[model samples]
Target: MRKTKWFTFRNFFHRSSLTSSMKPRPVNAYSFVPFSPVAMLDPTILTIGGVVLGIAIIERILERWGVIDLVDQFSKVMRFILPVTFYGALFYFFATFMF
Candidate 1:
């Protein structure tokens, strides 16, 4: 006599009764209200303003602690690095278009 297995490949792959009831429904993309440009820009504007304000406050604090020389040194380094980075990025961007 041949021995029978309880779990076959088909039985193992079959979904239970619980999962079959929770199938996903189709959705329309434009279900919500229409877009507003001002509403979108409000958060972006506030974020930029906050970043600028924070930088200014940090600079003021550093100056108060007599880090003017350090700040000047950093500015000198940034003057060189910024241009090199900008040109390198621009070269890569243009290269992408060419290739």
Candidate 2:
């Protein structure tokens, strides 16, 4: 007598009901609107102004403590240098890539 393949395979494994018990659930819609990149100036200006104000405050505090004179000199140089450097870089980047 020959043994069948189904009987041989059935002896090797046991079945479980755990897999059929679980079901996927749907996600709810988002409650808030997405951000727009076009109106960037308002936030950018506010952020730059806040950062400059904070740096000025910190420099004043450091000056009061009589720390190194480097901060004052660097600030003086940066006052003239930063805007020029920023605009130059901006123009170069845009002119090279955009136009």
Candidate 3:
């Protein structure tokens, strides 16, 4: 039996609403981990994450194609620490200033 477009959409949304309401039940051993913010809210973050992931991926592809290699094979632990701290501070600053 063929379903009407409206019935199909209604069924989809109804199923989504049911799923969204289900509590954070553990699906596996480590399933107690909190839900990611990106999963619970606006798709904007997901879209931005997709773009950032794409750029990072393309950068890798370009590096493979003989462009300047930005990533190091052996980076010091501090390499990640510094930029993350800087970005965290910058994000806080902007969040405070703008909001």
Q: Best TM-score goes to which candidate?
A: 2
Residue 32 local lDDT, model 1: 61
**For candidate 2, what is the lDDT?**
0.62
**TM-score of structure candidate 3:** 0.32
- After superposition, the stretches of candidate 1 with alpha carbons farther than 4 Å from their true spots are 1-66
Local accuracy of candidate 1 as per-residue lDDT tens digits, 1-99 = 967757677877783645453569898776364445444345544565565566557666877899999767656765686567656655654454321
Put down candidate 3 lDDT per residue, 2-97, tens digits, no spaces. 554444776775664533534687665665655454442445444555655665676677668765534443134336754775576556544544
Measured by lDDT, the strongest candidate is 2
Candidate 2's residue-wise lDDT over 1-99, tens digit each?
A: 955545345554565435653478898888464554443345544466566667777778877788758677858976986587657655654454421
CA displacement after TM-score superposition, residue 90 of candidate 2 (Å): 14
Which residue pairs in candidate 1 have backbone atoms (N, alpha carbon, C) closer than 3 angstroms, thus clashing? none
Candidate 1 overall Cα lDDT vs. reference?
Answer: 0.60
TM-score of each: 0.34, 0.36, 0.32
Model 3 segments more than 4 A misplaced: 1-41, 69-99
Model 1, TM vs. native: 0.34
